[model samples]
Target: MIRKLTKDDQELLMALLRKEPALNLFIIGDVENFGFEQDFMDLWGEIDPADGRIKAVLLRFYRSYLPYADGPFDVEGFAEIIRKDNDIHMISGASEVVKAFDGEINFKQVKQLFFAELKEMNNKISESFSSAEPIKKATVQDVEAICALTDTIEEFESSRNGSRTSLRKTLESNTGRTYYIEREDKVIVTASTSAENSMSAMIVGVATHQAFREQSLASRVMAQLCADLLHEGKSLCLFYDNPHAGVIYKRLGFQDIGSWTIVNM
Candidate 1:
């Protein structure tokens, strides 16, 4: 059976989500930050008749839908819920699970990326992997500079989708943070996290200036960011489709857990 979830279901909902915390970082963060009653967010669950326990979870945050299950689930039933909501512009989650919704959801594009998580740092990676200059954690004042730097990286050019307002809001809300390296007063290398909660965070917007590419600048920034987050006892996760980028993350102690798919409607 499928039903809308309320705060009363928090215990059940969190139990399922925490099973793979890194993979569900976004959903966990949203629930932690906005909760179930928000107009912009809603949650639903599929319960098993035999156990009366949640077997699948679906989340709607603004225009996006995220779905997850430990094993087989009623994909068609969840897809039905998504289809009835015209406000939904995208559906994203573990690729294997999300692909089942393709025919049910009207989407115009699909993005597939390898999902990875970092639980511990590799002993081989020395702290010296970071830049000689300390990486700076960004503040509201760095929004414009970060956006400018974002615009230069092909990988993240469309990642933020040109939303400076959103970027600014993220900074102000403390839901996210950016760690960067600057050269000659210009922001050059950056690695940021979004959808941060107490247990996990998703790494996004990793970019380095074109001139700084071969110098391991991106790795430096990412290493520092991941190290700090891990030190705080928060696991980190990221999405990457580029093989070269995958190599860098592997060296930083991230391993592929699954494939993440984002379908745009």
Candidate 2:
């Protein structure tokens, strides 16, 4: 009985999301598109009404979401959903569900890296670069500098959609946080972290000026940001596209949790 998530369902969805904040954030931003057809409800699943109590619920975008009260969920139903829709992939809390879809779904280990327990500082980049100034939150005046830094990042042109207006709107919102390393008259490096869930934050758009490379500026900025996040008792998650960057994050205390794969169906 899956159906489109209507405005009437907003309260129910928000309630469900309070229980799974990360998934809530992911879906709310693009409920209409969701990378598939067959309406929005085709992307969601709940325990059968006849099952007495609703034991589980799942939401599918291009990626799938499954949260359950019990340890294991209805994996077979999840598989059927994927098969019927031919959705590229799904993400879930239960490892068992992932394993159940192993043959039909391509699985990659996306590391949910964390720094929950801080260790003694060894080469604390922020500390090492004591002369470097503190990082600051970005504002509208910083838009040009931010766009330049984004340009420095190789993948931005090909992968990202939307205009500066859209980016500005997003940055103006409280949900996305952006930071910049200012020096003299310009911003040399920048990084931003979006809270994907109550417990998880995603670090994104870290870039530096070509002349600023090897000076530890990016590391120092990131170290300071990470320290602040750690102080607030939150964990950070980031995706590394290259082994070199993964090595860098590893030095900063991130572990390979798993991988995520996207397929166009």
Candidate 3:
């Protein structure tokens, strides 16, 4: 049965979420940063009666995001539970779960994504982009450039459905990093994490200028960023739907975990 989660269940919750860090990045990061009890957020779960382990998990963020994860789920039952809420921005998680959900819930946009992870780097990628643009971590001095890049890149993201984040706040939070390749003072490629925790980091904002594709600029920045995070003792997680992009990441050592889906409601 599905029920609300409380502080009393924190340990039980963390245990389940940690199993697949890549699939549950949002759930793990929010719980780590904001705690279990908050005025605007609520978490619920389905428990397996035989073993008492959580079988499915759901997180609702004030109608902005409702993310779910589980292998075996009663999608219709859970969909009915979420139907009671309003203004839900999206429902996201395993493609099977979310796709099944989109069939039951009215939605505005339905997106399919592939989730992958790299436990170890194949070999040190030569950062020797001697003749190429150098990848550097963005400082507060680089916010405007980052924003400009995002604005242009996002437009091509799914015919204008790409999500845009305030790079301004990302820099202010000081929790994650955005690495980019700059050519003659112009930002061309970027790789960054959208959420992070002590054990994991979720990579997002990964894009390259169309003119710069096929140059491996994205690979370079992503490799460097992943190395840095690995040094800090964090595993890397990312979601993508492009086969070409998946090849690049696999070369750097990421393997497919599963299908992740996002439905804008």
Count of clashes in candidate 2 = 6
User: What's the lDDT for residue 187 in model 1?
Assistant: 92
User: In model 1, where do residues sit more than 4 Å from their true spots?
Assistant: 159-161
Candidate models: Cα lDDT each: 0.86, 0.56, 0.77
lDDT of 3 by residue, 179-207 (tens): 99887788888888867787788888887
- Compute the lDDT for candidate 3: 0.77
For 1-265, candidate 1 gives per-residue lDDT tens digits of 9999998888888899899999989888988898889988889999889977888999998888899999999988998888888677888999988988767777799889899999998756756564387789998898888888888766665566755787778889888889999988899988888889988999988878888778888887788888888999999999888898899899989999999998888
- Best-matching candidate per TM-score: 1
Pairwise TM-score winner, candidates 1 and 3: 1
TM-score for each candidate, following the candidate numbering: 0.93, 0.66, 0.84
lDDT of 2 by residue, 1-265 (tens): 4333445555555555445333233444344233334444344545445743334455664345443323355666655666665544545542333445556655555433222222222355455676658688877667777876677667677634553564576577644567788777688888777633444456777788888888777777777777777676656656666777676666666665544333333
- Best-to-worst ranking by lDDT: 1, 3, 2
Model 3, which residues run further than 4 Å from truth? 64-70, 74-77, 99-109, 124-134, 154-165, 210-212
For lDDT, the strongest prediction is 1
